[model samples]
Target chain A: MNEAEIIQKLQQGNEQAFRHLVENYQKRVVNTCYGLVQNTEDAEDIAQDVFVEVFRSIGSFRADAKLSTWLYRIAVNRSLNHIRDNKKRKWFQSFEDAVKEKKAGLLHYATENPGTELENLQRANILHEAISSLPENQRTAFTLNKYEELSYKEIAEIMDVSVASVESLIHRAKT
Target chain B: MNCNTLHTKMIFFLEGELPEREMEEIKIHLESCTDCAAFAEEMKKTLAVLETDKTPQLNPFFYTRVKARLEKQAEEKVVTQRIPVFARILQPAIFSVLLLAGIYTGIKIGQPAKINSDQSVYTENEMIPYLNEMEAEAIENFLME
Candidate 1:
């Protein structure tokens, strides 16, 4: 079904429609959450919460924007909130934890190529650190634009910011 | 066309944000200016490296787990909805049945019968002593005051 139809079914409290929505966007949500939270376990948890919130709020969803855009907004907000709450609990963990938690993770490169392992690990560590170190809004804009392949216009809507602001934030992030 | 203007536009040009008409001016400047060209090249390399870095893929079980959780939530919602319907239909019937059983048990217990007139009179008179005790206590306190 098209988004309108799917949304209609969702509003009617159709479980299958909700399922379809979840199936279609779950990967994007998980990936985006993973990017923000940097921890798979926490990302997964936050992603689940995002869907639950979406379903609960779908009745009020106006189709002024694309469904994906709306879903991305929900995912981004939830991820940010998850990070903020975790910070309050003094449980903040770095993106490196995510890389380390990967099965075979950074170690796979080390074991496969003993020569460049140190260099590879160092580069990956630097990149992850840089990404994590970015201010929240800039990091979010950059991630949504780069990793999620969202257009600047779509991101602006998701972030509720001007397209110009998104561009400038992304530019600053790149530099 | 000057170094400062070219430097400022480099990022926008690289991102393809500049208008088509402006592209030629930028291109002309880049051909004559090695410094600007090098800066653009460096920016391109940095952006390229950033783009080429792969985000980690979620585990294979990721979708499976999500689907499971959604299905579970959906099932729970359905169950929750049905609960009220069941209660609405069954509650009054259960209450009526319990009420009837209570009344039946009460009736099954025989009523008290009068055994003797004198015994009933004595029972009635027993409450007056307690009442008199309370009255006497109240009057004594009043008189003492």
Candidate 2:
């Protein structure tokens, strides 16, 4: 079916149409979540959540952009939220547990991450930490550019920012 | 280009996004300036390492899982909406009844004494004589007319 027809079907809450959407964009959503969260299980869980949200609120979607862009936007936002919540939960743990967690070392986080090569694991982990430490906009721009390979114009559209602003964010991220 | 300007363009230079003239200018500067060249190389290496394919692919049944979750959510929504209207408002309905009972009880216990005092004036035997005199005067005036 054409994009408009598919969207109409989705808005109508057609089960078959929803299944089609889930099948088509699942990989992209999952991959984007994985890229942001850096954990296999959490990415999968968040990907499922992204689709569930899409189904629940499909009618409310403004559809001003491509479906895939909106999906990426959701996936990125959700993955970051998952990370933020996890950090907060960890912070709320007892002092002894927090000390133990610190003793476990941050490198352990990378070792368990799926798709990380052992040869470059340390470097990659450090890079991940650096990206995480960056401000939200810079990290998002850098991720969309360096990993997703989205153009500055496309990233600008997805991020709802000017192309020049995206360029500056990526520049700041690099430095 | 100077080192400071070259620093701003290093990312584009590494990505080879600069215009031909500017590219040449930066290249010449990099050739002559060891510190800038080193900095550029370091930035390039950092970016290269940053570009690793670290995001894991989703499992084959990812769509199935998502579909199942959505179905479950939809089912819950349906169930919640199907709740009986009275059952949904049961808590508030019970609270309102208890509140009204308490107010009625409080009024019965705290009945005012001023209402009894008003009744005493209307029921007094002395008012009967005044009422009879007023009726007598009306009859006398009617007979005179």
Candidate 3:
């Protein structure tokens, strides 16, 4: 079915249409969140929230942009919010405990060089921390460009900014 | 280009985003500048680390979990909507009871003080009764005149 039909069905509370949306955009939303948050479980949780919000507030959607664009916007916003919330919540924990919690949240990836797995994980954490340190817009633009492999134009559309602004954001993020 | 300009352009240069002329210029600069070359290499490695971090495969039952959450939310919303209706009925009754209690407390608290003050006034008037009586008689006479 077309976007309009799905939107109408969702507004009417159709289970099948809702399933279709979740099935189609779940990976993109999850991965987009994972790119920003750099944690599998948190990304999936945030993605579920994104879908839940979309379903609950489908009436507010104007369809001025593609549903996927709207979904990406929500995913980015929710992921950033999750990060902010985590920072506040983590403030109460001891440093050692926070470090342990971070390490535990990281998953093991299969590496081409087997012994380099730990090294790679450390590097990944370092890179994730570096990206996380960036300001919100730069981080979002950089993550969208690097992690999601979105073109500059696409990132601009999702961020509701000019392409030049996105280019500047990514450039600043790298520097 | 200067090293500062090169640092800004380093990622774009590595990504092949610069124009051909600018790319050549940056290449020449990188070839000659040891500091710029090292910085570019480090930046390149950092960007490459992004590839090692694989996107995790989402759980198979993600939709199922979302559906459960939505169901819970819907149930909560139903409960929430129903609450206000009952509250609408109960609220005024509770408010009225509180209102009556407040007024009763105020009257109870003030009644003794009010009676004492009124008794003091009566006593003071009794103490000066003859003066008040003469003043009243004088006014009556003046009116009659």
Candidate 4:
């Protein structure tokens, strides 16, 4: 179904349609969260939270933009907030321990891999980690453009920045 | 097209964001200047690398978990929405009962007035000593009003 039909059904309390919507966008939301949080479990939790917020507030969603854009805006905002709050919580814990655990996990997976596909996956993971390390604004701009394939204008709108600023951010991100 | 201008617009050119005139200019520059051509190629390669870096697919259980959570939330909201009706009626009824009970209690705790030497109503004998001569006279005068 088209976005309008799906949204209309969702607003009418159709669970099947809601499930379809979840199924359709779950990967993108999860990926977006993963790009921000860099942990699979946290990303999953954040993605679930994003959908819950979307469902609760779907009634108020205006159709002025694409549903995907609207969903992305929600996903980005939630992911950034989650990261900010997670950083605060992390300050109370051992940052070194977390980093060691992550490196160990990545090393274990890398050692077990024998195929080129595994190598590519490892590289992608590294890139994602690099992307996550970027300042929040740059990371948000890059992820929205790179993963969502959003136009600079759409990204600027979602991020509440100028098109020129978005362009500069992506440029800086590339370098 | 100047190689300098084309070099500056390489980012936009790669994304196909340039106007037709500028695009034509860049295309012509790419045809002649090896350096600008290589620059465009390098930019394209970077974008290609980025393009290949796909967003990882989420685990299979992700959708199920999200759906379950959303359903649970929706169910909760439905239950919450149904609650206010009963609460609305119950709230006012409870408030009115409590208000009436309070008034009844206040009236029960209170007593009729008794007159002292000053002829002013007193709820208790302790209030008589606090009455001053002028105040007592003012009270007596006001009573006549």
Best by TM-score: 3
Using DockQ, give the best candidate's number: 3
Please estimate how well model 4 matches the true structure, expressed as its whole-model Cα lDDT: 0.77
TM-score of 3: 0.72
Candidate 4, residue A81: lDDT? 91
lDDT of 3: 0.86
Q: Where does model 2 exceed 4 Å of error?
A: A94-119, B1-13, B18-46, B49-51, B82-85, B91-145
Name the docking class for model 4: incorrect
Tens digits of per-residue lDDT, candidate 2, A90-163, equal: 77889899667544544555545556565466556556678768887787788777767789998898889999
Q: Estimate each model's TM-score.
A: 0.56, 0.66, 0.72, 0.59
Q: TM-scores of the first chain across all predictions? A: 0.82, 0.81, 0.90, 0.82
Which of 1 and 2 is ahead in TM-score?
2
Candidates ranked, most accurate by lDDT first = 3, 2, 4, 1
Clash pairs (backbone) in predicted model 2: none
**List of chain B TM-scores, one per candidate:** 0.39, 0.58, 0.61, 0.39
Write the number of the candidate with greater TM-score, choosing between 1 and 3.
Answer: 3
lDDT of 1 by residue, A1-175 (tens): 9999999999998878987888788778887886787665677788888888787789889999888988888888888988788666555556676445544445653443356445455565466567778899998998887778888998899899999999889888765
The true-versus-predicted C-alpha distance at residue B120 of model 4, in Å, is 52
Q: Summarize candidate 3's per-residue lDDT along B1-113 as a digit string, tens digits.
A: 89998988887899998899999999999899999999888778777777755456668999999999999998998987887767878999999999999999998988754
Give the alpha-carbon lDDT of every model.
0.77, 0.78, 0.86, 0.77
Number of the candidate with higher TM-score, 3 or 4: 3
> What is candidate 2's local distance difference test score?
0.78
